[model samples]
Target: GRKGDEFAYSHVVARAFDTDHHQLRISSARLHDALQGAVAAMSEPMVSHDAVAFYLLSEEVSRHVKVVQSGQGADEVFAGYHWYPPLAGVDGDDAGATLDAYAGAFFDRAHGGVCDLLAPEWRLDHDASRALVAEHLSRPGAGTAVDRALRLDTQVMLVDDPVKRVDNMTMAWGLEARVPFLDHELVELAAACPPELKLASGGKGVLKEAARRIIPAEVIDRPKGYFPVPALSHLQGAELDLVADALHDPAAKERGLFAAGAVEALLRAPNDALTPLGGNTCWQLGLLELWLQAQGVR
Candidate 1:
């Protein structure tokens, strides 16, 4: 009933009839019907870009109600963006200039075009910045630069990036989420693909070529778009207050998920505070508090 009358009726009927019927029967039916209607409304190539349709088809065969997949790694692997191609093409001064351009673009986006947003106290001092940047941009445990890039990405961004988001969202609905693309085999295969093959001729060239073999060429060729979510934009008022509350809550503090001083420093710091304490620590603290509360861990 919380989602309204239609959802309540569907819930009751689903519960009264059969549990599987509610989840698979009603939900799948509605999803399929809506997708069909959407496809019909669009043009030939547009209909082919139906990732939802492909997902639903997989779901039907596997009887899995929920799935989460990330499409970012391939893009990263194959220099898919406008920036990466130019960076890769340059050498000597041109390469240095390209890196500067990339850094400028990142600063503009991350700092809202105001360099002053990064507080002087928290800003990376020259030596520290150089070391940090070197460490971050260097490829560890790989022979080639490309290999190192893949290893670093797989270790940090691909593996760790989506864990909390996927877990929290799926668990909220009491649904099991499967990530087929994250299968060990797929990860290894992606890592092993040659950089020249992966990044050939600009964009995620290899992935696009592979997709053409199975998917319609039109779908494969289309410019990629990010999956849309309004969560960050909508976090305000009660939501922002809830975050503040959780950070300062005595129970949360007692749980010792994060050092109290660290949490305080993050809150007290400016929005663009470059302090090491100001990154994912707040969310990590909040999730840890929720986990403690759920498990009665005190």
Candidate 2:
């Protein structure tokens, strides 16, 4: 315990973490209410409501501490996300083609499959989105696939999603969130390490080994995790009614924010009760309505 405590105090003591289990549930209890408006306010629809809701919920507890540390940049810099592995594109060795394969996987995975339910005109083409990724890939940076994935994420996702969400939500409640993993000196050093060393036999192998020396092997040996969330449970009662009203409302359907028939099809499926698209699409459309109503768009 001394060695573990000593190592943590010396190395990871930037700020204390908030880990009160009961407080966590109470904080996130209103996720549905928050997202109903927050989602509508976003410029893009693809941002994950589940993730953002938790980020906002964390801020609720983080308010007590005033300042808290976050493991924000670790995955982006260390190739920690399972999706960071590289794949071969149709045109082997062609940099642009290679990037297409890389960016395509990201788009398909992160964008949620709800595009199929969009009113034809609302579907995302990603010509514009692809261009953004293509531009990032073409930039001068690390050459390996894993390295490129890290490089691309550092420039794009690191700040856009993780860092931005934390900052926005926490600051809304006067909480300050610090990211030690994004240290300039550490990032510089991490970039120079061989790509294989980063994603070697396992993703984040180097980071995990360094952690192994100080922390128990069992603690650092676990598989990657997406924070567990009870999305279906959170949608029960008035929350479910909100989604139903948003999806089945004849007036809202006339405004053309969603394909009502398609969405209702999802709501009606007995086997698909817990489907991801069912929740994601409804949340997006519901939020859009809240935002529109707030701005007098309707």
The candidate that wins on TM-score is: 2
> Compared to the true structure, candidate 2 yields what TM-score?
0.73
Tens digits of per-residue lDDT, candidate 1, 184-244, equal 7876776677666767655667777876665555445554444321221222344344446
- Candidate 2: tens digits of C-alpha lDDT, residues 232-261: 324445655666776556656676755547
Which residue runs does candidate 1 get wrong by more than 4 Å? 1-72, 77-83, 90-115, 118-133, 139-146, 230-298
C-alpha local distance difference test of each model:
0.44, 0.60
lDDT value, candidate 1, whole model:
0.44
* TM-scores for every candidate against the unseen true structure: 0.46, 0.73
| Whole-model alpha-carbon lDDT for candidate 2 | 0.60
Deviation from native of the Cα of residue 51 in model 1, angstroms: 18
Query: Compared to the true structure, candidate 1 yields what TM-score?
Result: 0.46
Per-model clash counts, in order, read 0, 0
